[model samples]
Every structure is written in structure tokens, then in C-alpha cells.
Target chain A: MAIINYANKEVQFKIVFYGPALCGKTTNLAYIHSQITETNKGELVSLATAADRTLFFDFLPLNAIVIRNFKTKFQLYTVPGQVIYNATRQLVLRSVDAVVFVADSQWDKMEENIESFRNLDENLARQGLSLDTIPYVIQLNKRDMPNVAPIHYLDFILNDRAVCVPSFEASATTGQGVFDTLNTVSRMLLVKFARDAEAAAYVKSQPTPAASPMDGVAAGLRQPQAAR
Target chain B: MQSTPIVTIAAAEKFLKTLEEFLNHSEAFFALIIDRGGTILSQSGRPPDGTDITILAALAAGSFAATRELATRVGESEFNALYQQGSHFHILMNAVDDDTMLVTIFSTQTTVGLVRFYSARTSEQIAIQMQELRADCVDAPLVFTEADLNTASQIFRDTTDKAV
Candidate 1:
């Protein structure tokens, strides 16, 4: 969920990088953390195992842009891509506003990529969302490697959505196409947030109907009276 | 299905004041009200040198989530609070509501019992205000023009170009 704080003059969005294990999900984050100015980026926190595989998640917060007099901040996160960490991944996706589906470009990893994509869809479905509902972009990672799948073939399998969202070809370790992917997803998230805010304003401007008995009950139910 | 929560100027001021009062009473060096998603909503008191409050908020939220999971695994629905005692500093995190938590950093000088007592009261006050804020939240709508979005995109491009 995007938190727009008029008081603080700040708008915050959560963007998650998701893909299969060893698909350079952590590499994308590490490269960005290294490139971004220190003042604009926070410490990159990763909870991983002894082998450095992501056990929980990796987090990086960036505050670099201002839109409409509001300081725009993006909290970038990557879920543990291993199959056994589905629970941790779901926890990290709790309130994500956008996603970057980093697909491994090697031909042999196609099945893993497909399974991860389906997993993403299933997790979002559990939250009452879908790829169509949330703004997401695709990244064909490790393009610099040999024996990579053809770009057209990758698109045929993954980008065959109702609307083909933006996709980039990149080598995360060397920092190729990293910012392009980040910038595009960030822009899409900003635009969607703006449109949603406008729609909310439109609804709020409508006339309010007379309050009924059910209205009070509904309001009561909405209150978070419990301590926890 | 809930709309995105907005912290208006009035609400923010009230929250800061509440936090400051809690700090004064509890003698904690820092107090932060962070959302469940780990975004710092309102914070008060001076942090210790070399303390990254942003990262601290994120880690606190993560730790709290992990604790909740542990609670569930142990047959409890949830744990309302988490306390960590360090050599010189003690941190106490209490649940304010479903969407936010209260975190305080205190020295060994202050008793944990006092911190807990004040935290419960402060959290209750914050919970009421948060409930009221959610019930009737009205702030200026965030309307972005085409020029604004273009400017934002250009900023990103410029930053990326410079970094590269």
C-alpha cells in the first residue's frame, strides 16, 4: 500500500523484486545500492543463510525524487526466491505496490521461471489481487551470459499477458539495464498512485446518503478496538 | 479494500506531541510509531549517534513479524509485545493497532517496568487517535499533472545517468 502523508510531504511505495533462486534478485539490489548516492539510499539489509541464499528478504529504501511537492520514497525489497521460502515471500508481499519479475535468461531455467511466475500469481490471488491489478514489469536477467534464451521466446512465454508490461534485458552484476528497469517501474507506480488518488477524490465529492442502522454497525466493525 | 491511510498535518502534530510526552514520561531516548509495513509514521526524541532510525524501523517491523509467526507456531494467536535487552540499551516494541506499532529505545538507567507501563498507556492513546483518523480522514487529494510526472521521470533518468 502507498502511504501518502500530506503532513510530512512524503509519498512512500513498496516495490518487490521477485524471481527464482539464483536468478540475480539479490544482485539487482546490491548493484543499485552500490550505484545510488549514499544520501539517497539506505543500508541494504539481507537475511540469508550461511550459503548467502536469501532466507527472509532483502530491503533497500531510496528517497531521491519529488513529485507535486511531495518527496517520493521507494522501499525496494526482494523476496527469498528459493521454493521452500514461500511463506517468507508471502510475508514480504504483504503490501507491495509494484513488482519487478526478474526472469533468468538461461534456457535451462525456463521451467523454474515459469513456476515462480505462477507462484507469484497464486500468492497475489490469495491477497485478492492479480498481475492485472498491480503494476509490474519484467526483466530478462543475465542476458550477458552464453546460451541465453532468445528474447522473443522469453516474451512469448511470460509477456503474453492481456497487456504486455515493460520488459528490460540486463546483466545485474555488471549493472546493465538495471536503472532502466527501476525507473520504469517507479514511474508506473507513481502514475497508478496518482490516478487512484484522483478516483478517491471523485468518490469523496459525491453526496452522502442518509445514515441507516447498518451504517453505524459497519463503522463499528471497521474500528480497530482490539489492542493487537 | 481500505483506502490508503493519509496522515494529515493536524494528526501528525498530535502524534508527535503524544510521542514527546511519552518520551518525557518514560525517559526513553527515542520513540517511533511505525506502520506494520515498516514505514515510520511519526517519531520523536533524539536518537543516539550512528543510529539509523529508518533501518531500525524496518528491522523492528521484521522482527515483530517474525515474532508473530513464532507465536502462531507455538499455538498462540499473536504476541502483543517484544522486548530486547542489550548491554547499554533496551528496546521495547508494543502493538498500537493492527496497522502500527510503538517502538522505544531506552538506556539501562530506566526500568523496563516503567517503560512497559508508559508504553501501554501511550499505545492506547495512539490507538484511539489512529482509529479516529481512519474513521474520518480527509486531506487534500494527491493530484499530479502530466508535467509533474514528466518531471519525476526526468529526475530518475538524470540520477541514473549521473550514477552510471
Candidate 2:
């Protein structure tokens, strides 16, 4: 959901980071929060267990871009990736504008990656949304690990979706490729807004069709249906 | 939730003003209206700088969400109100609508009974207006041109910094 606050001249969007357990979803957000200046970011909040595992979600609010005299803000969130946290993940995914699928690139984690990807699609569908149409990117994370799989194979498996979205090789722990992933997704969301605005303009310019006698009867029928 | 519940600046400010009046009568420290996603829509009677209102809003929303689950597991529909007692101050939260929450903070000067009684009345009054505001929210279309995109891209230019 994008918030257009006319009073404050601010536009806000929600972007969620999702993936399998221990895929560095939280690390990506921590890196971004640390890199940005205090004036450009908000306090990063994490609800986790004693072992530092995410219990529900992590949130970091970033405000930097200015569009059309309005402050463009992005509320970044990371869902709990553990398998048992599926219900919590579904709750966070609601009203999302975009998603960043952070995949663990180690050879041993491929199965977990694939299962999480499928779960993303299923959860999205339950909300009447489709991952195929939503603006998203793939972050192949943990590339610094020795057991990591090759980028080509990772892409062949995860990135081979209907649209073949952008993919980045990232070491989230070291902050490699984190900003790149954020920048691209934010740009995509802005572009999407532009396209939607254009479509709205085109619709407004179109002439209304002439109404026939049946139009009144049809409207009368709708009144009773609406009252019921 | 296909259409975003647009909280216009005008609507939010009006809401805050109303809540502020209630805070005065109830001798409350502050009041905050938050969206379901944990964004602070409006706030009244500011707390000290040491209190991060943004973080407070997020945590309050999270707590309310977890409580909602607990209510359902106990074979209840949902718990519309929550109260937490601190050392010197007490907090009360209520649902203004399905997508919004109202939180009031007060010290020992006020009683929980008074806050709870007045909060329910205020929530009902605010919920009626919120329904009307949400109806007009989606109608305000965002009209962006090429210039907006160019400016947006150039403004966030520091995203490439590799600092961790």
C-alpha cells in the first residue's frame, strides 16, 4: 500500500524482505540502516528470541528521495523466515508494494530456497495478489561462503520465473550488493506509480458513452440490489 | 485491502486535534492514532524527546497484533482494548477501526477507569468520521510525470555508499 499524505506532502511505500530461515534478510536491512545517515533513517526495531532469531518482523524506515515536491519514504520490513512462522509471514506480506526475495546461495540450502519461493507465491495468492505481476528482485546472498552455488545455477533455478527479474550476488553480512538491490526495487516502484498515473490520465480523457433508456432501468435495479 | 486506506494530512490533523482535546479532559500524557501496518497516522500531547514516538507506535501495533491472536485462540472474535501498567504511567489501546488503533498514555494523575470510559466514546466518534474519510481516500489519484521520476532518481544518489 502506498500512502499519499497530501497534508505533509509525503508518499510512503511498503517493501518486504522475504526468504528461508537464516537467509540474511535481517542482515540486509541492518546494512542499509547503518549505511544511511541518521537524518535519512529511523530506528531499526527487531522482535527476536534470546538466540537473536526473528520472532515476527524487523522494520527500518528510510526517507531520502523527493518526488514532485513530496518526500518519498520507504518502510522496509523483513519477515520471519523459519518454516513454522508461515502465519506471521503471511500477516506481514499484506498490503506490500514490492518484495525482495533474499535467497541463501549455498548448495545445501537450495531446497529451502525453492520451498520458500513457492510459499511466497502461495501466500500472495491467498491475498488475491500474484508474485508474477508484483515488482520484485532476487538477491543471491551469502556469496562469501565457501559452499555457495554458482550464480548461473542459482539464476537458472530461482530467477527463471515468468519475467526473469533482476538478480544480484550479495554478501549481506559485508554489505555487498545490498544497496543495489534496494535502489533497483525502489526505482521500479516509482516507475510503476508513473505508469499507473499515466493510465489514470488516459481514462480521464476518454469520453463517456451515451446512455440509453435501459441505463435508467438498470440504475433503478441497482438501487434495490444495493439496499438489500 | 486492495485500496490503500489513505490518511490525508487534513483528516489526520483533524483526528489529532480531536484526540488532543480528549487528552486534556482526561489528563492524559499523550495519544497516538496508528495504522494497521504500524505507521503513526496522528499523535497529540507530545512526549519527551527521549521517547521515540515512531518506535512506540511500531511496538504498540505489534503488541496489539499478538494480543489479537491470543483472543482468537481463546475462542473469542477479537479483543478491542488493551491496558498495560508501568511504574509511573499507564497505557490504554483501543481499536478505532479494523485498520486503525488509538493509544492513550497517562500517569498516576488519572485512573484507568476514566481513560477506558472516555476512550471508548472517542473511538466510536472517530470511527464514524474515519469511515467517511476512507471513502474519499482512493479518489485522490497520484499524478506523476517524467520530471518527478528524474528528480526521484537523482535525489537518492547516495545509495551506492558501501559503508556498513
Candidate 3:
């Protein structure tokens, strides 16, 4: 869920980078963390194993942009992509506003990418969400590799949806397309917020019961954020 | 399904101030309001320079999430409260709402019972303010104008330039 805290004049949105194991999800975060100045970014926290595989998730809180006097913050998270970490993946997906589906572009890893995407759908469905509803972007990572599949083929497989969402060709380690992915997702979130606010305004203008100031923190929010 | 809580800077400052005063009066050492994702919404009281609230929030959220899972398996709907008793100080965590939590750290001078009692009340008040802010936000216009978009675009563009 996007946290638009009027009390603090700040808006925070949670963006999760998700993909199969070793698809460069953590690399995406590390690259962005290194690029952001210390003043605008929090310390990057990674819960990983001795071999450096993520055990739980990686978190990096970034605050730089200000929209209409409201400080905009993005809490970027990368779930442990290993198949065994599916439970943790579902946990991390809770309340997510946007997602970056990082797919390994190597031809041999195509199965892993497809399986992960299917798992993503299943996990989201468990939470009553669908890819069709949430604003997301696809990142075809490891594009610089020799064995990578063509962008068009990847798009045909992943982007052939009701709507073909924005997809980026990235080499996360070398920093290619990292910021482009971030920038596009952030803009998409902002646009979505604007549209939702307009709908909320219409609802607010109607004659409804005077809502209990304290009620519906979860129930009322479920409507706007969960709407497809 | 609800919109994110929209907190004005002044309101946030005011709430922090109020929380600071409350902590002092309650004899607590620190207070932190964290969102469900474990992001520090606001914090009060003196913290050591090395205190990383981000990690703390993330861990706390993770702990709560794990504990809640345990609760469900044990036939409980959810665990709304958590307490950890340390050697010198005690910690208390109370759910402010479905998506928010209040964490209090205090010395042994203040008993857990007192902290719990006070924190419960404080959480209620905070929830009211937060929900009201959310309610008021419906009328709050999106003032993100063309200039703001350009500025944002330029800011990201600068970052993109660096990354490239």
C-alpha cells in the first residue's frame, strides 16, 4: 500500500523487486543504493546466508523527490528469490504498491522465469491481487550475456497480456537500465495515485455516513489500494 | 484497499512533539511508530547516533509477522501485542491498526504494566489522528503540477545519468 501521510506531508510507496533465484534482484538494489547519495538514502539491509543468497529480504529506503511539497519516499525491497523461500516471498508481497518483475534473460533460465512468474501470480492471488490490477514493470535482466534470449521473444512470453506493461532491458550489475526501471515504476505509481485520488474524491463528495475517524484503517484502505 | 495515510509535515512534527512529551511524562526512553512494512513513520526520544531505526523497524515487522503466523497456527486470529523483557530495559509493541504498530522502549524504572497501559491509550489516539488525516486527504488535491513533474523527471534523469 502507498502511504500518503498528510500528517507528515510525505508519501511513501513500497516497491518490490521480484524474480527467480539469481535474477539480479539484489544487484538492482545494490546498484541503486550505491548511486543514491547518503543524505537521500538509508543504509541497505540484506538478510542473506553465508553463501550470500538472500535469506529473507533486502531493504533500502530512499527519499529525494518532493511532489507538490510532499516528500516522496520509496521503500525498495527484494525478496529472497530461491524456490525454498516462497513463504518469505509471500510475506514480503504484503501491502506492495508496485512491483518490478526481474527476469533472467538467458535462454536456459527461461523455465525459471516462467515458473517464478506463475508463482508470483499464485502468491498474489492468495492475497486477492492480480498482475492485471497492480501497476508493474518488467525488467529483462542479464541482457549483456551471450546466451540471452531476444527481447522480442521475452516480450511475447511475458508482455503478451491484456496490456503489455513497460519492460526494460537491463544489465543490473553494470547499472544499465537500473534507474530507468526505477524512474518508470515511480512515475507509474504517481500516476496511479492521481487516478485513485480522483475516484476517492468522487466518493467523498457523495452523501455517505460520517465515517468514524478511527474506523476502516484496514477495511477502507482495502478498497482503494486493492482495486484492480 | 484504502489510500495511504497522508500526514502533513506540521501534523507529523506536532505528533512527534506530543509523543516526545508523552514519553518524558511516561518515563519511557524511546517511542517509534512503524508502518506494517517496518518503515519508521515517526520516532521520538533521544537515539544514539548509530541507532538504525530502519533495521529495527524491519526486524520488528519481521518478528511481528512471524509471531502472528505462530498465533494463527495456535488458533488465534492474530497477536495484537508483543513484549520483550531485556536485562535493563523492557520493550512493548502494540498494533495501532492493521498496518501500523507502536514500539516503546523504557528502563526498569517504568513497569511494563504502566507502559502497556499508557501505550494502549497512546496508540488509540494516534490511530484516530492517522485515520482523520486519511479522511481529510480525500479533499487534498494532487498539486503535482507540470513544473513538479519536470523537476522530478530531471532529478531521476540525473540519477539515470549517473547510473549509465
Q: What's the DockQ for every one of the candidates?
A: 0.40, 0.47, 0.38
Tens digits of per-residue lDDT for model 3 on B1-164?
Answer: 44446556655875697678669767898899887777677889865457677677877787777777788889997888899988987778888887788888888778887788888888988888778766665566664544456556434543547543
Candidate 3's displacement at residue B45, Å, is 1.9
DockQ of candidate 3 (2 decimals): 0.38
Grade the docking of candidate 2.
Answer: acceptable
Model 2 per-residue lDDT tens digits across residues A1-228: 676777777777889999999999999999888778789888999988989899989988888677667888888889999999887888788668899999999999999999999999999898888877788999999999999999999999998876899999899988888888988888888788778767777786788998798999888887755554
Q: What is the C-alpha interface RMSD of model 3?
A: 3.2
TM-score of chain B of each: 0.89, 0.87, 0.80
Candidate 3 local lDDT, A105-163, one digit each (tens): 99999999999999998988887789998889999999999999999999988888999
**After TM-score superposition, what is the CA distance of residue B2 in candidate 2 from its true location, in Å?**
6.5
Which pairs in model 2 have colliding backbones?
A: none
Of candidates 3 and 1, the better by DockQ: 1
For model 2, what is the alpha-carbon lDDT of residue A163? 84
Off by over 4 Å in 1: A208-228, B1-4, B153-164
